[model samples]
Target: MRVDTVGAVFDALADPNRRTLIGFLAQRDTATATELAAELPLTRQGIAKHLATLKEAGLVRRRRSGRETRYKLTPEPMTDAIAWMATVGGQWDDRLEALRSHLARGEH
Candidate 1:
């Protein structure tokens, strides 16, 4: 995934409300903003705003079903983000191991 896309995913996840919405979406195939709002403390407008952010981050997708817009989780971007994190984490592990070896050798 592109850096900005991963950044956007992280940005969207930074908010607790957005995370809650994601959780709700994960449990179902699709949900309308009204349905999601009923499960959370936020109003429908607030849920809509959070869903917009999630859509921008490629974390969620929406479709029109009659008069309602049903939102569903699109997990591809999140998978990419997880891969990026794994790559960075592996690099850190290598660096830490090298540092440990250096210290064992009495190097500053």
Candidate 2:
């Protein structure tokens, strides 16, 4: 997984509205901005803006059908991000375990 891709995913996910949008998309598989707006507290235009941010982060993909555009969550980028986080978390766990062992031995 690319570092930039992970960064983009994190940045896109930092917004609560965007995270909620992701959850909605995940549940529905695919939906249009108008549909999301109706379900969410935001307006259609607001939903569009959030979707655009998701698209830029590679977290979602858009398709046009007739006159309306539908958005779907793209899990690949998020998968990459999750994998990266797991790796980092593992390293931290290892370090903390080592510190615990050292402290047990009274070696600071």
Q: Which of the numbered candidates is closest to the native, going by highest TM-score?
A: 1
C-alpha lDDT of all candidate models, in order: 0.96, 0.97
The residue pairs in collision within model 2 are: none
Error of 2 at 67 (Å): 0.4
Worst 10 contiguous positions by lDDT, candidate 2? 21-30
Using lDDT, give the best candidate's number: 2
RMSD of each: 0.6, 0.7
* lDDT, model 2, position 96: 96
What does the lDDT come to for candidate 1?
0.96
The positional error of residue 30 in candidate 2, measured at the CA in angstroms, is 1.1
What clash pairs does model 1 have? none
**Residue 90 error, candidate 1, Å:** 0.6
